[model samples]
Target: MLIRLLYASRAAEAVTHELIESILSESRSRNPALGITGILCYGADIYMQVLEGSREAVNKLYNEITCDARHRDVTVLHYEEICERRFAGWTMGQVNLAKINPSLLLKYSERPVLDPYAVSGLASVALLEELIATASIVCRP
Candidate 1:
């Protein structure tokens, strides 16, 4: 069965290009082999990612993410069996929230930041859709 899993976490330390690159590199390498596709959004020491793939693969990856040492306060925002992927253009696409206009963020949440912890999972998903519509997500690191 195909599944979609969305989760958010706060960086354990400073958010740097190296750290983001490292994560993207790993995702680009490993996700394709595992049949996972998704988008990653990062800013304000926050990370919000969505993984789409087979149920087992998505679940295992979520478990691994929860145990990863690079981030803390991992929280699942959404998970469901889906008929099709909302993000299928790349093995792992990315959005640098800092690079987007703060007004865009305000459209979804109270403030201009990625605080998935404070919003409904559906609201977060809506933000992802908006990102797709605006062509804000990048495929390469």
Candidate 2:
């Protein structure tokens, strides 16, 4: 089954444009073979990534992502079986949350790497969706 997982975490430090590109490049190269596609949003000191793919593929990627030292306070906001690919066109789309909305963090989450919704709390799928929609509109215009 196709899996969709939305999660957020805190970046160790502010991310540079080069760093963002490098991360996205690595992510696309690593997951293209597994048929995964997703968007990554970074705001303030946080990183929010929504990944979708086969069960095994998604699980494998999540395992590696959780272990990566670049981020902390990893929280899975949403996870479920999906009938279709949400990001079927992109191998690994990346968005600088700052560029889309410098206040994206305020629209979705908190800081300190240990926010109140880190676990068993409100999930902000709306915020993620808004980011996606706004980014698309801006890019298309």
Q: How many residue pairs clash (N, CA or C atoms closer than 3 angstroms) in each of the candidate models, in the order given?
A: 0, 0
User: What is the RMSD, in Å, between candidate 2 and the native fold over all Cα?
Assistant: 4.0
The digit string of per-residue lDDT tens for model 1 on 6-48 reads: 9999999999999999999999999988999999999989999
Off by over 4 Å in 1: none
What does the lDDT come to for candidate 2? 0.69
lDDT of each: 0.94, 0.69
Residue pairs with colliding backbones in model 2 are none
Residue 15, candidate 2: alpha-carbon lDDT: 76
lDDT of 2 by residue, 82-112 (tens): 9997677677776655555435545455542
Specify the highest-TM-score model's number.
Answer: 1
